[model samples]
Target chain A: MSAKKLLVGIFDDDHTLIHAIEHIRHDGYKVGEVFTPFPVHGLEHALGLRPTKLHTAGFMFGATGTTFALSFITWVSTLSYPNNFGGKPFFSLPSWIPITFEMTVLFAAWGMTLSFYYLCKLYPGKQPKIVDPRTTDHLFSMTFDLDGKDEAYIEKLSSLLKAQGAIEVYIKEL
Target chain B: MSHFESPLREPLITGNKTWKKITDDIVVNTTGDIKPLWLIATLISAAVAAFGVFCIGWEVCYGIGTWGANKTVGWAWDITNFVWWIGIGHAGTLISAILLLFRQKWRTGVNRAAEAMTIFAVVCAGLFPVFHMGRVWDAFFIFPLPNTRGPLWQNFNSPLLWDVFAISTYFSVSLLFWYTGLVPDFGTIRDQAKPGSIRWKIYNVLSFGWVGEAKHWERWESLSLILAGLSTPLVLSVHTIVSFDFATSIVPGWHTTILPPYFVAGAIFSGFAMVLTLMLVARKVMNLEDYITIAHVESMNKILLLTGSMVGTAYLTELFVAWYSGSMYEQYAFANRALGPLAWSYWTMMFCNLIFPQFFWSKKLRRSIAFTFFTSIVVNIGMWFERFVIIVTSLYRDYLPSSWIDYRPTWVEVGIYVGTGGIFMTLFLLFSRFFPVVAIAEVKSILKISGDQARAEQWDEVKDDDVYKTLEK
Candidate 1:
């Protein structure tokens, strides 16, 4: 049940925190993950995080939303039993364009939001680990995923945290 | 803990009155004028709104002819003012929603009040159409009604119907978005308020049952994210649909395809301008320099520059499309807007929409509160003229020379527009007097972000203690 994992060291500035998420392809021990309370301008590349694909998800959700919207209106106006108004033909798609467009956008936003929620696992019944109570008020945190490392190595990681200007350090199991 | 490190700093606004003192003061202490300025302003606005209501009432009683709009100008002041106010609503949502999405921290101070402006502006907007039906009593005819006497379903085929859905959805959702953001801030007011008074009751009801719990923060953050996402496109769609009411038609100048994007752009442009106008006054009147920093105003001014340029681009696009489409009528309509008898309005529009915002690109002008304030008002005037030119110039110079008539808004139409101003300010005054002008929780979050650098230092010390006492094996 207890498996040794990567021992990653994190260091950061006061009034900020860092997770040393640096990889160790052939490591005895190394830094792994870091978090800062506020975005540190150059930190993304430091963490080796890939550029976010949120916009891509946004566009897909938007497109699917648009189709779902356009089609639904089309269905209702034409096939859902149409009442011909102002002598306009049944299934007048142009007339439906505004609503369809609105719907597409609505759905895209709704879908994207849900996807974001799902990704973050941000709904009920789950209590988020309070890395620090002041994280909500005034604190930053840095975390590292330990991988198959010795206890002494973890101590070394903790020492590295102190040396790197970390104001505080704590182990967190994710 | 260091004296400077105390998180329990006294709130900026506090009540000196105790439970009974507050009640007695509220009930009997009517002498001193702490808010007499707001009171006078509210009364004036209410008066104007009442007069405007009368004008609308007359328009309903007699018909659309009670106003200056005639058959040849089937769409006139009513339509123009409708678009103008809805355009005003855009600023609130834009200030709050889009800026929030971009993580523009400065938005927190002004967004709450700006959103109230949006809701009130939309209410003002919904009025014109409701009364413009010539038969105001039959206004509900626009809705999907089950009628006894020819109970007619809504015309789904009409772009106007789409407008109905768009505007109402926008109003309701914006209200929800605005209100949801206010709950915790209202709770702050409720907790901080003196007990057993109207202020207490008011804030308590408005806040619902918000607790400053972490779980609530999680839900709060997500819901805000979702609402912002919804509102971003809703902001675009509301005005786009409004434009569709004109673009989908075969009317000479109105049928242009460039409208939806142009309208949306113009909406945002005007909206930012209005936000600046209101915020400038609010900061001055309420002395909210700390809460609404100069940096926030500068950021808002910058947005005005960007969105105003977008609107300018739209104006140019309209001219280009008129020429490129090879339609002589469309070309003529464009020409009439500039060269016709009412050409001054067109030029004014160009100056306000295009030139005024350029001042903002200057770092000095953007930061100069005085200049930005004037420019904001100028931008609003330009947006109003933009509507007037669209509605008036094109219609006045229509195909039939016989129908060519110089149009002037009668007292009724002018009075009504002025009256809507009353309605807007009245509601806005009530809002400013009652609500907490900023989202406290959100502000706290931003402050945390600001102070993150300090806590980062303490974290190391904590880790050292953990390693020595707990981690030693």
Candidate 2:
């Protein structure tokens, strides 16, 4: 990815950041992103973002796991090495319930976490670009793209951030 | 909504601490000098664990015959310890997963330590099954793999095989869940570390490059919720599978419909007790009384009370069903458990699992640290006896009266059991000494809600002078 200069606003409080998002958007300035130490309540609404549908992915994974477990057990019990186990039915659906249920959970938990990591672009060794270290500590940060913004407009945005109780406002290349 | 719900109920984290103060409070413990208690505790545990390792190594060399297990009492202390340890692991998932689903904020304080307990307990549990097999090296035979021993295949119909899959899956997923929760906290510790130092470098790698961006938080939130949903059922299922190891068998006491739920309740009861036992020690030793407040302790006591009653109900139901079914074998099994040579164990289980938790009904007792700590230890001991009563007593007298024989654990078996405690304590001590025992990020998330508002208000009334308040304001 090409490194680009971006305008960043660091708010001290979550409420101030939320208010900054609303005011900046109203002022016709696009609020690129807001970062916080914790998930600020209703920040998504302020930023106008969509709710996540990761649960849908989880459901699909769970269904796949259930099907795979059942079919595998059935195949193993019936065709692979079919034997009369205590004179029970070859495809004993009742006895297969435990493994079936467990597999569903196993696959879903593992599948959903991996997908979450992929979606978030997080892994073990990949160094992520951080806006500010204190974003993880106690600071709330908002980033705006400065691709084609004029210097005067940038000055206005920084002034607005200060007016909204920003702890610090600065620019970074990422 | 009121700013403070219960003024009397202690705030989870005491003190009007800032972000830096909290970081310093928890992280400094790791980097600072080890307390004398920590040193003594670690040394004792490690030494016991080493002795246990010696016992196990000796048993491994000699075979399973070194223990007191016999033809009649084929499954004894080893399996009992296995199930007990596995049961002890259940609360971690329940706290981390189920409580997350239910939106219990109090869990944020205890879940980190409990999850650590889960992983360590599972590690200890895993040792038993592997060693219990006379041929420890051939434990891989439990897996359903393509093999060439006369074109043999695994018995998929067997609950034993299901256990292999269940425990392994439980351990791995629990590790993931625990690690995922630790990431943000680890990142916090990393951020607080001195730049370019060993602490920073080590934490930097462990934190997985966490930046706490909102997008990452979004995914983190979703991942947590989804994992919680997945793990909720898993907590129940893991114990159910463990119970099936007995319930699926044809033995009279073992084969019962109530075993799954009964075992699940017992698992949670034991797990929570173990958490309390360890957390009580940690809270005292680490000076984290505010974070792990009395309310947290009482809340856990309530769970112990609830689960203990459920276990008691299961025990009664098993007895009622046994007598009502008019099955001679079932009746005999129940009778033998109470009146047989192992009657002391059965009574201990009854008293500890059923009778002791009744004291928690007293609000005074539930909140008292001494009472809570004592009960926690007793409950765990009771849970171990519960396993002993169930496994050994049932197996002691088989269908044939001629084959009836009393089983007593050899010193070797007792050493191994003690060794597991050593191993568990050693791991827990090391984990506490090095890692963040509390979920720092999660605790911060609830600061506005669950924090001590009295102190916050006190601090807030003078916000003009407080540097941290200026940032918040």
Candidate 3:
């Protein structure tokens, strides 16, 4: 008689939680989300999430930084005013290395961090949903939606979650 | 199920003493918990550091000639001290960077102290260059200025300028990295502080809104990873450019392309050895054996061996290249290094850096706490000699046969060198006393993840909360 269907399961470990997304999907259940306090490798693929394109953007930003840093130094040295000290030629490439290398790395790191934060919509003051505070110190979790249709099916699912070794269970709604 | 055993050792002192109790005990000498000998030694160091600062002030006022520098040895003790301090600074980055890359969790225990070492080392280094320029007030000459001189610019071609850039960058990056890591630890201290305490206010001001939120934990990891990556390169470039100071020059002993890699290796080698030396003593004195284990001591020894071998190999390659170059000056430079005025130091260096690490190949020596501790000290001594050999041996034998004059470091030079040890230790003591010598958060994390299949099974958290509750409560 309930209008909402519910699904429940647990995992042997966080690694299992990460891998279980595929199994849950293969069983013909919609995986509305996967939640973990800390990162578990391969959770993205398990949940059918798209690959991040931040690294590629980082490379572009780094190259731009390198070029910008080198060109500015060139402008400072050769075009702006050239002075020869100790008989060495002006606009020396080897000399520009420390600054250029520094800028490239600085740009790549900052660029990548900013891109990830922006793309992920992460900002200061945003209160993230926490299933367990212990995740920061030591816990991991995987959660999926259980909404719409069948009471007997929900009981069977909750029992299956316990069988998978859940220490505790709750009928959480959000 | 069988219970998992903790591999951690007990701290030297563990009890329910409050901060007030601890401070009262320290001031009143009610508890002879720490050895008097160690306390006396620390005080002596503090005294010498005070004297050293006075001398540095005198040098700044009267110029670098206050010591034994002349035209032939234009860069004497000043540059030597610079190299020494910078080389020592490498340990912090090594603990934070290379060990982090390897996922060596042992690093969290010692990283705070090592990072403090880096900051102090940089401070000592900055002092030398400031005074080395005769007109200390005009030290801005090293920087590229718009109107200091007609089109005045720092020579990009000069290794000195490179050093200026490298050290400044290394210092700034290191400061940022250390401060970022310290923020949360400051929070822990803030919570433990008594109400209205100065420490509480300081910690509160410094924590920067670190509420220990789970999401901030995620961001912290990302930020640390990026800092580690950036710091790795920054640390490498710093010592490499230091090598460039000698490498790009045409001087017989100074000029060699191998210098960069060799210097970086030696810097890390010496740095680790110094860290071990200080840590062993501190662990015993502070009663922190559990926090800093024998495993950590062994890991550092292994690194010492690897870097020592690398340095030895560099030494051999230098000798070979000198022979193969068919240049008589290069030949004499190598020959004089072993049999010259400071041949004793050269051999002492060889013995410490070359022969001692071979003992580490034996697990018995490496694992023996006493042996490893002594070996660490000896390796530090050897690394110092290696620097002395590289600086004095080459310069003592100049191109002009008549100009080949023997030089000896003055008592002032020796005093200042030893005094830096004082400054280093004093700062380290202050750091340990004031701050969390161990990264409490990271250690807590590592310990939590290490065991507990139940938590691993049910909670997606890497750690076991039951264990934390037991330990902390």
Docking quality (DockQ) for each candidate: 0.08, 0.55, 0.09
Model 3 lDDT per residue over B146-254, tens place: 7735665555667787787678767776776787677666655554555357755666666553445323445556667766877788789889989988988888988
| lDDT per residue (tens digit) for residues B194-270 in model 1 | 54467655655665543343234444565676678778888988998899888887767789888998898888888
Off by over 4 Å in 3: A1-68, A85-88, A103-174, B1-43, B194-198, B449-473
Candidate 2 lDDT tens digits, B1-473: 22444333457777776655666677776787778888999999999999999999999999888999999888899999999999999999999999999989899989999999999999999999999987888988987677778546666778888888789889988998999898887777777776567877788778787778676787788888888887888888889989999997889899999999999999999999999999998988887886899989989999999999999999899999999989999999999898977888899999999999999999999999999989999999999999988888888889999998878789899999999999999999999999999888888777776678654564555556556456656
- lDDT of each residue in A34-86, candidate 3, tens digit only: 43333444566676665555556767878987898788778767866787767
Q: Which is the better candidate, 1 or 2, if ranked by TM-score?
A: 2
**What does DockQ come to for candidate 1?**
0.08
Give the residue spans of candidate 2 off by over 4 A: A1-3, B1-10, B454-473
Q: Compared with the real two-chain complex, what DockQ does model 2 have?
A: 0.55
Ranking by TM-score: 2, 3, 1
